[model samples]
Structure formats: C-alpha cells, structure tokens
Target: MQQRKQQLLRRHRQRKRVALLLGLPLLFSSALWFWWLPLPLLLAAWVLHEAYFADHLFYAPGDDYDYRFAGAGVSVSITADGRLGLAQLEGIAEADTLLLEVTIKADWRGCWVDPRVLIDVAQPHDQQTFERGCAGRRVVNLSGLGPALAAGQVRLRGRYCRLAGQATLHVLRNPDYACQRMLILAPHADDAELAAFAQYQRGAEVTIATLTVGELEAEPYQQLGLSAIEAARLKARLRSWDSRHAASWGGVPAERCFQLGYFCMQLPAMRAEPLLGHPSKVAQTGDIRPLRKGNALPLPGDVDGQPSWFNLLGDLRGLIEHYQPQVIVTPHPQLDPHADHQATTAALYEALAVSHHQPQTLLYYANHLHDNDRWPMGEQGEGVALPPALEPLTVAGVWSPSLSGAAQIDKSMALGLMHDLQTPLPGKKKLRRVLQHYLAGRRWPRWGVDEFYRKAIRRHELFFVQPWPIKDQAQRPE
Candidate 1:
C-alpha cells in the first residue's frame, strides 16, 4: 500500500507538471481573447485535484485500546483462499453483545473506488467499509449473535476485497451504554445532536449542557446585513434558542438543556488564566451572560456571569453535583483538534477533581478529526465505523448504538434546525462552488459534505468509552 501510494504521488506530481507546462500559455492567451476559456480550464484543474486528492484511501492503525484492555475472546483466521474464516468459542460463556475487529490491507483500486467488505457470520450479515481509503482495523457490532456464538465455533463466510494475506479477526465484548442519568457536554450547540442525539433520544434521564452558543462564525449572517458584532449577538441568541428546540427533538426539554454562556475560541485563553475573563471577539461582549433567562446554572452572588475558566468549572461542578449523572459524554481532548473542545474536556476533568464526582462511565466523542471531514466513508443511513486512525485511539471499548431509519431522519431534522448548519448563499462564487462539486462527483447543499447531517446522521453513533476518574493525571493527554 505504501509503495502504491508513493507511485500514485509521483504520477500525480508528473501530471501536475505536464498540465502546467501545457496550460499556462493557454491561460495567458485565453485572458486576452476568450474570457470564458479560463473557466473550463479551471474546471479541468479541479477535476484533476478531485481525481488525485479528494479521497484519502489510507489507514494507519492507532493504539488499539480495546484489544489492549480486553483480550480477544476469539481470534478467527481466514482460509488460504480468503473466502472463509472460522472462530472457535471454547470455554466461553453467554454474552449479550460483542465487537468483531477486522484487520485488512486496502488495495490500490481503493484510491479510485471506495472499498466495501461484506462479512456474513451465520445469522446476520454485516458490511464494513475502508473509509477514506483506510484499511487498518475496523470494528463491527455483533448484537444478536449472543448464545449461538457462545455454543461452540462459527464459520465466517464473506466476500473478500483485494487481500494480500489472511485477515485477522478478534471478537471482544462491547461496552455497555446503560446509564441512570446521562449528561452530554457539547462545545457548541449542535455538537450534542451531532454526537449523541440518538444516544439521549431513547435513554434514561438526559441533560445536555452546551459550553458555548457558537456565535463566533458570524459570516453566515452577513447576508442579513448586520454588523459583525450585531451578527455575532444574533447568531448567539438564535443558536441558543435553536439548542433548546434541537434538544427537544432528541426528547430533552428546554429546562434540561443548559447553555453555559462562554465565548467561542476563547476557552484556550481562559484555560491559561482561570481567574481572568475572556471577551468575545465576534459579539463584542465580555460577560458570561446566558441568552435566555434561567437557561443556565445560577452563579453565586459574588461570582457574576463572567466568561472565565473558574466560572466554567464552577458551572460544571454544580451540574455534576446537582444531576449526579452516571454517564458523562464529552469530546476526547487528544483526538479532537479544536481548541474549544479540548478546553471543555479539560475543564470537566478539573471540575471532576474539585468536586470529586466519579461518574460510572465517560463517553468521549470526536466531532473534529484530522483533516478529512467526510469520514465513516459512505452515504447517509450507512453504518458509521470508527473515525480515521490519525490519533492514538484511547478507549476501554467502542459503543455504536444503532439507530432506526426513523431515528436517522429525526437526527437529520434536528441538525437542520441549527442556523449554522444551513448552507449559505454562495452568491458570486456559486458557479465555482457548483462546478467544483459537479467535477468532484458530489451534490451540493444536500447536507454539505462536512455538515453533521452527513457525518452524524448515520445508522449508528460512535463513542469511545474512556475510563472514568482517570487516575494519576497531572494533566489530560497532550
């Protein structure tokens, strides 16, 4: 795979050089006579870019914490012909749920066409994709194969893709998602919906606490002819309102959804000086003021609403003490590259330490992964596998709660309620955007490629179950 990638890179560079050599003179001449000629050339250039760089079809295995913590229950080896595999369940008791991890090497053809591997283990058939051309280790949930799997051995017959050698399979127990009370910590308003709308929609007592109203990116409201500050304020208020409505779609009421008013992109600065308040650059407001009355935890008399790390942690501690949630869902600091997300989890840990509240489970999610936005590698209503193995994955086990088609539609509708998720009017650049999507073999504004609708509204939502009350932590992982 590495050699094939290198070869493709060399060919891509060669193609670029050849195109430039022939196209520069044409562009110069076209500028003088045919103004429209540059447009076709531009479209051609975009085509070349999409053909070569659009899909990332490479997978490097991250730290397999699941296997490291829970040793394989059964290791199945494929037959010499790569058509059949077998797993012997000896001395194994009855289990409710299990996770099957498959290690595969993607072929060069994966670059042009997305690779889909179908594995049929007796009763239920499952399909797994090497998302974004990744072919390291992909896990599938084995739900109904309970007592039959523990009876004895099982034969695994599946259609194989391009395989170099025998595939290795490890069957391990999946994490439990049972919780009495669940609290989701979202960096922004839509984040809770993106990561765990399905999780809370049909579960025990649930509360969503949004860290910020996500008012920083006011560019979308520029069409409304509002000034930057006014637009930011409006964006903040509307998204805060949208959060309650969106959470309602997930069965969480307005009273249960709390918006901890903090400025976007200011968490890192607040983390540095916990006592100092950080002002919003977009809204031009410095105070930590909730948009709606009684929509947030009440601050102490001495501690007014000021956007500071101390206040943020205080709110988190207050929630933890008040709700006493068994499951706390937040972003993984290491995997998520966003500064606000990292800071949100960091504050949660500090609050946990100060409050000394040990939740039974900590569900960590990563909405912002390494470069590629189009991950899980398929259309909507498809199984959402693990994200690209860019960062060292740290989790006790993987939990992928399957959502019905109706649930997926509800998630899509919930995501659509967010003003930020709506596609902005391309205006003058509309033609360029259309041509780019057309040449890339993609449809525009049908839940934009990077939106939560495409990324989150899937057959299942994925979460990494990190150990609760991390022991001996000087600081969160870097």
Candidate 2:
C-alpha cells in the first residue's frame, strides 16, 4: 500500500513540472508578439504619409512650371582676325569679318535655351551683327552682319547680368559636372565624406572643408556624456582620424582636407562682431584658421601686424577665392535640422555672395533624417526629395544618381572607419551610440549597428540645388 502511494505522488510531481515548462514559453512568446505589433503599424503609417502627402511637395501635374528658371545672362569676349571665343563661331567669320559671340550660363535657375545676346559692333567702325535669342549658345550666329562687327578694327564691348536663378534640378538633365575643382563644406568631420563619396569618383579636384573641431559631439557632458578632458582628447583623435581617412579614401593627398578650427555647436549663434564693445560668448578667432585641436587663445581683430582677417565670413571667402571651384557643395541651408548645418550653409552662401568667383553649380545634401533614437526608415535607394515646404525655393526636383558597386563598397568602408562602439568609455558605455541611433525596434540588441549603417548603403544618392530668386529670407538670407 505504501509503495503504491509513493508512486502516485512521484507521477503527480512530474506532471506539474511538465505543465510549468509549457506555460512559460506561451507567456514569453505572447509578450514578444505584442512588442512586434506596433512596429508594423508605424511602418504602415510612414508609407502612407510618404505616398499621399510627401511625394507631391514640389511637383504636381498642373502647377504651371513658371518658376523653372532665372538668371539668363551673358559674358562677351572679342578678338581680331577670323577669331571668336568658340571654335564653331571662330570659323564663322571670314578673314576680314570681325566676330564676337556672348557666352552665358543658366544660373541656379534652369538654363535658358537661347535668351538673347546683343553684340555692340558699333564703334569707330560700325561693322557688326545684331543677334537675338543667342545668350544660351556657346557658338552664336553673327546675325545682321556689319563692318565693325563685319570688318577692320572693330572695338566690341559687352555688358551682361550674372543671372541668379535658371539652373533647375532635373532627374534626367544632369548639369555639366565640375571636373576641375570641387568644394564640399561640412558642419562636422564625417558629414562630407558620407554625402560626397560619389562626387569624388567623378574625378573632380575635391576639397573638403570641415567647420569645427567636432568637440561638441564628444562633449564630456551631453554629447558622448564624457568628461571634459576625455571629450577634448576624443575630438582631437577624431579630427586626426577623419583627415587621415579622407585622404586615403578619396585617393588624394591628405593636405587637401581643411579643418576650420572653431568651437563646435556654437556656429548658428556666432557673430562677427561682439556686443556692446565687448566680446560676449564671442568665438575665438584663432586667426581664422581651420580645426585647431585645443582652445584658441584670445585674439585681437588683427593678428601679428596683419590687418583684421579675423572673421568666419572672411575665412570662407578666402577659401572660395583660392579654389575658384566649379562646384560648391554644402548642406541645405534652410531645410537641414541641425543648427550647425544651417549655419554652415548660410556662411558658405554669404561667402559666395561676396566672392568674385562663381561656381557652375551649388548642390546640397541632407542628414539628421530622424530623431536620434530612430533610423533605417526600413527603405532607401529612392532619390532624395525636397520637403514640400521647400519646393518653391528648390525650383527643380532632386536627382537620385546611382553609384557603381565598387563605389558603394568604398563608401561603406570609409564610413566604417569613422566611429565605433567596440571601445568602452566612462559609465561602461560605448563611446559612440550610432547603433542606438540607426537601427529601429528591439532588434537592435540582437544586431550590430554597423550592420544597419551598411544596410543603409544605397546605390543611389540624392541632393537639392538652391535656385536663384530664392522664395524668401526664410529660404535664403540676404
């Protein structure tokens, strides 16, 4: 009787253990399924928003494309003999025929196919041609030919307005890319290379200029949540790392990298002149130099017997004048979410406004896509589009150009060299939280952040060009 009772008790305990094991899995699985439910809902919302509301920001079927272009203007050069600036027009003139054609480029607005070029063949010798609808062509016809424009010792003079808007962004119509010189501006170190890797492949003489020491992001307090000394050291290390990486990645000598030494995160509020005859949180000029690793000593308006060359605007203009780049690439001035990025754009624009040099194209790229905690968007490869509010100033639709497979790989490698989470900092936290920022959902703990950044690697890149006659001060400041 005792043995039979014991057997019964043992069997009952076994049954209870089996039940508990089965019940735990059901509870765990239910919790996981509940967490995944909202993720799909969020994705659906994003898709709906993009298709219905976002796609039509700048373009619709019947918006009357009148704002497509601006700044149709001309530049004139005259020569003696059967010679004109353009090869086609040079042959147009007979040995005794004086020939001059106006060369004009479509500005930030779309190109004017053939505006009008009026050649003043009127002089001591009134031999010339009166031409209309000729501003857009490199080789222009000498219409209504006369002696001064037609014959001996003709003095030709031309006046042209430098157009502001005419070049519009086109999905199909790519601008004559800048081959000789390219100037890329970044608010911080890693920004330029990420956006402009494709630009480098075009074989342009690329110059990347970074705006600050990049210390703010490594801040001992909020940025990386580091101590001051550690933050400064990290900033210096990052600057050095970026410079080295850019040189190697672009296949250019390292010296081409320019790091303008300014305090990070202060640009948007920075001023050239201090208030009330006092320097109030004034930026240290440091002789208007680039990326000095440490705090700059207080500097006077003038340095070491040199005239006051101590202004942000002046420094940027100096770079512009020096490079005379055919293309000036920077962040979207008004559209960018980051204050430093906006400030960088404004500074570049101000410098361009003052400098005599002109670039054929002013292109803008974007980042700061989501709140720091969210990323991947779960989609990519579609070209970048201007936000609807920015459509009027954008003038042309942004283009998404595809990169070669090798180029994409190179971009990935370059970005990888930028920052990492493997190394630990204070509080036993990783020095960089790029993973936490890039990947979406709870899966981040399971997958590495580098993998998400790599997944974001798209074959196509996108950008908006600022059209001249910008809509308002909100779009572009005077």
Candidate 3:
C-alpha cells in the first residue's frame, strides 16, 4: 500500500510539472490574442463610422474657421453640426501659417497619428501637408505627400476616441492688386452702361450677357399701369415699339419674344428666347445663368419642372467659373422691390455661401419708386435731390450722391438700365431725373454722398479669402 501511494504521488507530481511547463505560454498567447482583437476590429469600425459621420464627429473650436491662400488669410468656423458659424477673409496675404502636431499614447506601445497641416492663402490657391508621429518623436518618412501646394483651400478632419480635434492653418503671400478682376452680373440687356463704367475705372475687362425667360405679349399694358383702353392702344402700338426699341443695344443680341405685353417692355425685354443670343457665352460675360424674374432674360428650363430657386445655385457657380472675376456686383437684398429682383438677390446670397473664391467688393442698387405716399413729391416735383445735386424733389427717398462720384453714379445708372431696360414709372422717372440733376453737381462733398442712406437693412455678401494665422485666442485683436 505504501508503494502504491508513492506511485500515485509521482504521477501527480509529473502532471503538475507538465502544467507548469506549458500553461504559461498558452495563457500568454490567449491573452495576447484577446487584447489584439479590439485593435483590428476597432480600427475597422472607426473607419466605417468615419466614412458616414466624419463631419459630425469632428468638432471645431470656435465659431470662426480660417484658411489661407498665397499671402492672404481667412478665418471660418463651423459648428459641430457642420453649419458655418463665423467667417472673415481678406484678399491680401498678410498672415502666417499654423503648424499643428497630433500625438497618441497608451502604455508602452507607442504610436503616432498622422498630422495634417492646413494653410490658407490670400488667393484661391492654398497648401497642405500630412505627417505621422507620436509624442515628440517622428516615426515614418511621410514622403508621399506630393507637391505641398494646391489650387484651393485645404480641408482637414479626423476623430480619436474621446480626444479628436482639428484646426486650420493659414499661409499668406504677397498682395497683388494687379491680378484683380471685376465681374458684374445684371439681369437686363443693357451691357453698354456696365461696360462703359468698367472702361472708365480702367478696371478689369468686362463681358456682358443677356438672358430672357417668359413673355408678356398676351398680358394687357394696363396690368403694367396702362388703362384697359390704354392697354388695347399699347397692344396696337406693340408692333411699332418692337421695331423701334426691341432691337438689341449691347454687344449681346436680344432674345426671342415669348409674349408681347407691357410687362415685357422693360429693358432687355422679357422674351422666350435667350436675349444675348449666345447662351454659351453668358458665363463669359459674368452674367450667371437661370436669370432672375422681371428681366427680359429667362434661364433655361421649364418653370414647372425647374423652378428659378432650384437652378439659381448652379447658375451662380457657372457664372463664377466662366468669368473668374475678382469682384461680383448685384442688387441689394433690402430693396424689397419686385419679386424677381428679390428672388435674384436671395439666390446670389445663397450662391455666396458655397463660393470658395470670394469677390472683392459687392455693391447694392436701390429700387425704383413705387408709391407717392411712401415718397411724397418735394420741390422740383421729384423726390429729394440725390446727394451731389442742388435740387430737392420727391418721388423716392433721398440718396446721398456725394459718397459715390459722378463716375460711380453714371456706372450705376448705366448698369441699372442694362439690368432693367423697362420704362421707368412716374415715380422711377422722377427719381431718375433727380439723380440726373445731381450729376451736374460734380464737386459735391464726399461726406454728403456718404451720408445718403443708412443701410436700412444689413447688406451681406459672401466670399472666400486667406485665413488669418492666429494661434492663441488671447493674442487675437478684437
């Protein structure tokens, strides 16, 4: 019995020895595999999530987001929800670039996340670079980044566990005013006025295009202010009017006649055909497509199938691309004028939202006179004399012609004629006449013109500029 007990003990010892020798490696391998599962799976999951929710996952620091092109700098901030929060850009390259380093850490195993560098320029051109690193040390050669500079701004975004973040850097270049060009978008067919203005300023070369949409041939003239008898008479006189004024004036030819009514009698005339006769060249003339309402020009599409609102953005983009103008001028949003005018201005604002290459300046034009009650008759039987003029009349509100020179006024009026082309109502005629009178007061005080009208409403235009390179919030000036 003792011998049997010894044998059993030896067997037990042998089994224990075997377990001690092999158990550690097995446990170690299993543990290693278990820990590793999360790395690959988590990476895959993260990638997939990012594919769909990258914008949502990345959070911007403040309301302002910034970028740079050449020497110019811009600041723009987007919300976590991807809405544009704050934007300030300048055409001059006066700021520096920002460099950001991203690091990751966990236990002994060290790894470096790719660092993305963004730089905003004064012009549309910008640059970016990406590098991989961890802690304060670099690991990989990051050589594949390819020629660092690009034609547009850089967009950087990423997420990491509970610590994901992103920032933009701006690179400034020297200012080059000679490179500037201006683009004027008008709804009417009077390109001559704008062209003359452009020539007078020695500004960039200008191109004019016309668009014609619907017609008002069947519509009565009285609907446009003529009495029923007047409408009939006007209709009878339509043939003569067409032969006399319907002919094209600007370099661009006139569009087809959709309808022949008084409403269609405005400048550039509302025709069913493309007024410029060159639909293809509309963009070259700096005239965006899908013309807004009230103008003689109509955008391409069926009103029922393709609404003006829907196609406005695309048209604006096309215009920007075609003209490549440094500055864009359109009507103001506040005028609360005609439906088509309002709609066009609204669309222009919307287009500015997505435009990366912002225009340098935006000018707003006042609407024509509407009611005598709103604009009572003054001395001279016209609205108050615009600034730069000595007469006081009543038709529309007074405008300070002093701020804008006669040159500017002439250009503005010319552009207005090009855009409207319609005969001014009594109120509009009175206002125009007043404006004309002011033209005689060539040496008006600058302050007088400057003090014309308080921008009753905020006039906002959107454009992309170089991002300012500001590191610390405290260092930024108000």
Candidate 4:
C-alpha cells in the first residue's frame, strides 16, 4: 500500500509541473497582444504628429513638368502701372538672338490660367510679331531679322501659364540676373544709427559680413575643391559643430549654415542687424566689402606675428585688435562654401589656441535658403538635414528667442522688399505663408538670462557662461 501511495504522489507532482509550464506561455501571449500591439500603434501616431508639426520639417519635391521654350525674342518691362508687359520679335530674327525668359510661379497647386503679360513700349504701333501657343519658355530665333527689324526694339511679355504658386519667375538673361537682382533688392544700411551704435560705449567691437559659395549645394565637393574624402571629413566636422552646440542652438542652426555654403549670396538686407542692434563697429568682409563704399582693409593673410589659417584671418585678427572687443562674433565653418568660412573658423580657433589676452569668441549661424520648403533637409539630396553630431568649440552660441512673431514678420517683409529684384514670380504667395508659419511656430527653450553663450548641442539650444580666463592660467572650463 505504501509503494502504491508513493507512486501516485510522484505522478501528481509531474502533472502539476506540466500544468505550470503550459500556463506560462498563455499568460505571456495575452500580455503581448494587449500591450505590445497598442504600443506600436501609439508610437506610429506620435511620429506622424511630430513630423507634421516639427518646426524643421521640410516637404518633398513634387512631380516634374516639361518646360518648352517659345522660339521668339521677348522683352519684359515693369510698367509704371505696376503691371508686367511683354513684346515679341519682329526684326530679321536670327537664331540665338537675345531671348528674355521670364518665369512666373504659381502660389499653390492648381490648373493653368492665361494671365496677361502687359508690355509698354514708347510707341504702341510698332510691328510686333506675336508667337501664340509656343512653349512655356521663350526662345528667339533671330536668324531672319531684317536690319530695319533688328534696329527696332520690341517688348515681349507672357505670364506663366501652368506652374505651381510657390514658383517664382527665374529670369535668365544671357548671364544670370538672379544674383544681380538679389543685390539690387537688398536693404540699405542705416548709416546714422550704425554710427551711433558703433560709438556706444562698450567693452567690445562687432563686425558683420556675408559670404557666399556659388552653387555649392547642386555640386558640393567638386565645386568647392574638396575630394569625396575631404567632403566626408568636412561633413563630419560640421556634425561635430552641431553636436557641441546643439544643447543651446538646436540642430537647425548648423544645418542652415551648411546650406548657405552652397547657395549663399550677400543680400543687400541686414535682417540680423536689428536683432543684434548696432555693433560697436560694423566691419564687412568678402564680397560684402565691395558693397560698402568706405576705405576697407584688404583680406587678412596673417594674424599678429603668426601664420594664420586663411587669408581672411590676418584681417580678422587685426580687426579684433583694433576693435579691442571683449567678445567677437563670427559664423561657424558651416556657413561658407569656399574655404573662407572654414578658414575663418580655423583662424579664430588658432588665435584662441595660443593667446590668453583675447576676448570671448561667439559663433552664430544664419540660414542659407530663406524659403521653408528648401530647408537644408531632403530637398536638395539624400543626406540628412541635421548633422550627425556636434563638436566642443572654445565658445558656442545659439539664437535668441527674443524676437516676437510680429517682429519676425516685419523683418521678413523688410527682407523680401529689400530683395525685390529676386522677388518670387506671381503666385508665390505660398512662400510668404510658409515663412509666416515658421515664424509663428518658432520657439527656443529659454535657458534663463544669465548665460551669455548658447550652443545647439542636438535637439536643444543650450546656454553657456563665457567667462574670460585669467592672464596666466588655462581658459576656465565653460
């Protein structure tokens, strides 16, 4: 009887173990179905929300359209009536005659409409040849022009028939007029206020300059004389800059600076100045020097008694000494395409590397392209918009959120007006709307008022105290 009881107990224990093992998976599977399934859905929704509302979000480019040219000589004029006018070729037209191509962009996605291109010639009765239903582009074959017709100046005008609203008329002359128009429409400097600001008692001096690297975005490394390896290195360096400054400046600033390296041209307008107020002195550099009528120093080749990094360094060092500024503000390396910005950054880094008497240096980044859709993201190519990382710099700074929405709007309007020559083609109202939307949503996490230098370390803008070092000791840790 005892043997039989012991055998039964062993069988009961085995049954209990089997039951426990079977229950474990059922419990686990239940938990996963109830919790994990919902988690993924929730995460997806959050990602979508963030993508739509993120301040740095950029839209993808739409489908491409076939643009054909009307084989005709065209002249475009802005009449006193504030209306656009056009005229066609009537002369012994020859091939490759000067064809004025005016592009009018649409404000939004829509069908094509026949908008009149007005033309005002001194005399209205001139024999003007009209080419109807030609391609969207204007082409003049002046091969058959008689001398009499060749001598006669004909005005040509046509509105953009079918294009998106965000499109701007990119008028292409024999030589590109985009840069010239951008300059012509730039803002005028405030001499009196600037002079007064320069005179204001301060411990430091300030200089403002704009640098450009033509068509860097479309052809980055090759155009800029950088090898693929060098370009990769440069990109890594830029990422380091972004990472180091991201805590204070956000990742967008560095990206903006990088974009500027490619498509940058100095605009006549100084939108940043009002925010910065008047510097102790405004020393312009690069192409900016040509715009200023004052006697300007040549680009620097050396600093103090040392060989500088780039030609502009010597001048910057001299300027720093002459100004005796307690703080020096300049663009980060990402801002320029030609080795100019990188050279400047290197020079500043070198200057600070050896000297104990120098003032605190702060780097500020400006946007390269103003339009929202073109934010240094996927618009141009496959590379990521934000840098992969940031570097530890001697001193870093971030943009202040002090400017109000209205103020930003006013500034944008002023800048747009200043760059009237580069004005978007008709129906580009969407660009203005996009800019306004950006301004409205723009905000930087305030890090209190005491921190002087702010760096964008990653996703956030961080502020740092820029204390000067003692004369004999290593610079204090920021």
Each model's RMSD to truth, in Å?
Answer: 6.0, 21.8, 28.5, 25.9
Best by lDDT: 1
In terms of lDDT, the poorest run of 10 residues in model 4 is 178-187
Per-residue lDDT of candidate 3, residues 27-65 (tens digit): 557567796654565455444333322211111111111
Q: Tens digits of per-residue lDDT for model 4 on 333-419?
A: 332222233333344555555543476434233222111222222111111112111122232222211122343333222222211
lDDT of 1 by residue, 209-255 (tens): 88887788787677789888888999999888887667887788888
Full-model lDDT, candidate 1: 0.67
Cα lDDT, model 1, residue 59? 32
Best by TM-score: 1
Task: State the weakest 10-residue window (summed lDDT) of model 2.
Answer: 125-134
Each prediction's whole-model lDDT (CA): 0.67, 0.46, 0.30, 0.28
Error of 2 at 311 (Å): 2.3
Candidate 2 lDDT for residue 412: 66
> What C-alpha lDDT, on a 0 to 100 scale, does residue 15 get in candidate 2?
66
Tens digits of per-residue lDDT for model 2, 277-314: 21112232333333332212222221331212135666
Model 4 root mean square deviation, Cα atoms: 25.9
